[model samples]
Target chain A: MFRKYRKKSPWILHYNAGSCNGCDIEILAALAPKYDLERFGVINTGNPKQSDIFLVTGPVTFRSRERLVELYTQMPEPKVVIALGSCTCTGGVFRDMYNVEDGIDRYIPVDVYVPGCAASPELLIDGVVKALEILEEKTKAIEKPFRLFKEASSENGIINRRHSALKVGEKDEED
Target chain B: MSKKTIHIPLGSQHISLLEPVRFKFECENEKIVGVDSDVGFVHRGIERACTTKFKFDAIGYVVARVCGLCAITHSLSYTVAIEKLLGGEISKKAKYLRILLLELDRIHSHMLCLSHTCENAGFEAMFMRIMGDRELVMEIQELLTGNRIQFDYISIGGVNRDLDVQTAKKIIENLALVKAKVFSYIDEFTNNWSLSLKFKGIGALTLEDAYRFNAIGPLARACGLPIDVRNEIEYLPFDEVGFKMQTHNDGDINARNMVRLNEILNSLEMCENILRGLPEGEIFTKLKGKPKGEALMRFEAPRGELMYYVKGDGSAMLNRVRIKTPTFACIPAFSHIFMGEEYADAPAILASFDPCLSCTAK
Candidate 1:
């Protein structure tokens, strides 16, 4: 019954961590009339307390990082985070830009990943559906809240967040 | 004696969460008492680069890249400007092709702005539906120009490639599909009470304010001003083509979206008319010599009026090329629109202007 409820209503909060509006435009395109996502009960909410899924875009900027963390913390439990577009998932073409924070997962833990320059409508809708499943799982584990990346170390502290999948001292290509 | 003064270093570096606009948002208790904008980021010195780096005809392709979304418009305006300077006349058939491509571009760019605005407003379903429909426009562009985004189709004197009969038929068929979806969504979106409440009068800018700001595109048109460049400029046969100029008096975000949506419909019809009445002739005019004079050409890009000022020396290379994008003209308008609105509505309202950072910064 709870699983069905999660599927029936997955409230989302979209945050533009900072991007070229291309991906951001694609994200919005997924919501308009032709895609008709409202039939799935995937509504967008401005309030974090009401949101079950956080659809974060762009390659989180340095200045927006703290604000993002604050927003993430403000959300209620049983939440699933989705990093939308190539920028949030891997920084895409802007990986080398000085101001970009690399990727959103560098700051917040992400459960579902949608990849595209600005992801297509089909892909974005699919990602939202997948996030609802994750939301269902988080609801079951209410007592423990939710953990995204198991490898996320507490030692780094909030100011210096390590990429969840990144290993210590590894010279990996920055996503 | 009473004295008060505070200096907040806004940006030639930071402040705007979107494009590289540095502004000092001087506030007294969260009310913006004063604002100052410091532009010129990613200036790449494109104007200077155009004069020194590119040949007269080659610059058409370079200008297209100035704004990824408005690429076709920039290239179209540039080609026309150069043709005027060269004193060359494009074939009637080429004019029809130009009209077809421009309308297709307008549809794509407007849909993008609508969807992005909905996204910023936290409406995902609306965004998706608009975007899905947007692909049809992009597909049409790709069919015409071979590339989805920056279509290097427009050339000096005329188009580089002709719109094949088969492709024209496909474009017409695709537009039919878009029409169905667009109408359905418009009905759904306009009827949604929540969407209406969120957008209706939230970002209202008076006609006077818009005039003072010198807003362009849907923003200016939404305020009841008939400022379409197509209405003013002397293009080949746009006069014979029948279509209504889209406008609204609400002067708010919703009005802007409505204007864009209507423009898409009008654009589709314009494309169909051009295809049906396509004239048969050469795609480009043969030019053997160097350019000799300066030319100013303007066009109605999806965002608004786009002006191209090109100066050619007695050589193949251009001496100077200056572009005044619609968004550049709307900077003062954005400031005016931003006044007295909550911080939350700032970005969405700003986006409704269809501000392309690439075009403005260039």
Candidate 2:
């Protein structure tokens, strides 16, 4: 029931691991009246707990790695992570720098990768739109039954059932 | 009654902040007593990368990535330093075009700061309005340069793009619209009650404190400290293009806003002058020889004075590259201003200062 409403207003949490402020400003521009990302029901919230999408910019610096993971963990399940900018995806310019940790994907699993030195507002909006669809899919997947069928088991009951159910769900999803 | 102080941390990742910078504020009740800031969150070791990773010619674009807002200033300062090392003179038209982009960058950066300040003050409508109007400047910038944020406009010897009649006309039209919007903003900023409550005398730095702390840019100018790099530097012809110093005596958040607004007016005038009387010449000048010896260049970024020192040994690679960013210079002043202000006003105060951490850390 709440899953339908979840897709309508998916709040975003933006974290700059080590960006040059180019992509960050572009994110603001996307939120502003010009691009109007809010029309798609996106609100940039500071708290990770309240956010549905984690929009991260910049390659993860060594010092920021812990904070990035903490933020990712703090976010609720069925979250979509969008790596916004070339640096965050593959550490474009700042790659292989002494202080930088290359791309953020080394630490957090990224769902969508938006590439640009400072990804434009148009690209950011597209990324966010794609994130919404992913968020909805994840939401549906989470709400699905963990055990599809009740199989007769003697020893170690329900231990291997979770893995079997996950495999079945994966096969069904592929179909 | 016992007085107790609480340690409150602002960022690393706060919605108010554009970049990642953490500030640990020691507060007693509502008043802030001490402040410690960490700006290394965005540090990507660009200075070392400039010397080792990239060649001298490509460093202009590399340094531009230091801060998106002041990308042009970073490239311009570095390119000017290299040009100085090579001892080659660029055309008068290219110089004027450089100034045109620089002033345009300042206008948009200040507008972004102003809108951010409004947002911090809990005036969401004003933030949206200012942001909406700022697009006029951004539109012209995109029209002038290929990209919106990272305008790799300034290259070695000359700019990457040339100004045409259609683009110049469009820029003039946008400037006229933005100028009118800025005037209305000035009126609203001065007379608005809520803004005055948050801005007037809040987070103020006295003239003496400004000097003692060695504040630069609008923070210094707000305290009536007449230090502007554009007026001092001869690398670019800022003086010929209607440059004026804007200063205020209050040194408060409002004063800084006033100074930035007035500077926008002056910048608009300069852009108009440059477009009207642009000298006719080739935009690019092919200069020979690798950069040798050392050269130091300074330019007034939107935040403050941005200094770049380059040491080359007549090779493709540079021996050393040191960047002294303005926010790094004004750290003392920033901490000092936070000493006596209310803890609740910290975000607004920080916004008014417009501290660009990317520039600082890089």
List the candidate 2 regions with Cα displacement exceeding 4 Å: A148-150, A153-175
The sequence of per-residue lDDT tens digits that candidate 2 reaches over residues B1-362 is 44988999999889899888999999888899999999898889999999899999999999999999999999999999999999999999999999999999999999999999999989999999999999999999889998899999988999989988999999999999999999999999999998999999998899999999999999999999999999998878888998999999999999999999999999999999999999999999987899999999999999999999999999999999999999999999999999988988999999999999989988
Weakest lDDT window of 10 consecutive positions for candidate 2 chain B: B1-10
Give me the displacement of residue B31 in model 2, in angstroms: 0.7
- Quality of model 2 by C-alpha lDDT: 0.92
Summed backbone clashes in each candidate are 19, 0
List runs of model 1 lying over 4 Å from the truth.
A1-175, B1-18, B22-33
**Cα distance off (Å), candidate 1, residue B175:** 1.0
lDDT of 1 by residue, A35-89 (tens): 6677788876667777788878767666667767877998888888988777689
- Relative to the unseen true structure, what is the C-alpha lDDT of residue A137 in candidate 1, on a scale of 0 to 100? 71
Rate residue B25 of model 1 by lDDT.
Answer: 58
Q: Work out the TM-score per prediction.
A: 0.69, 0.96
Best by lDDT: 2
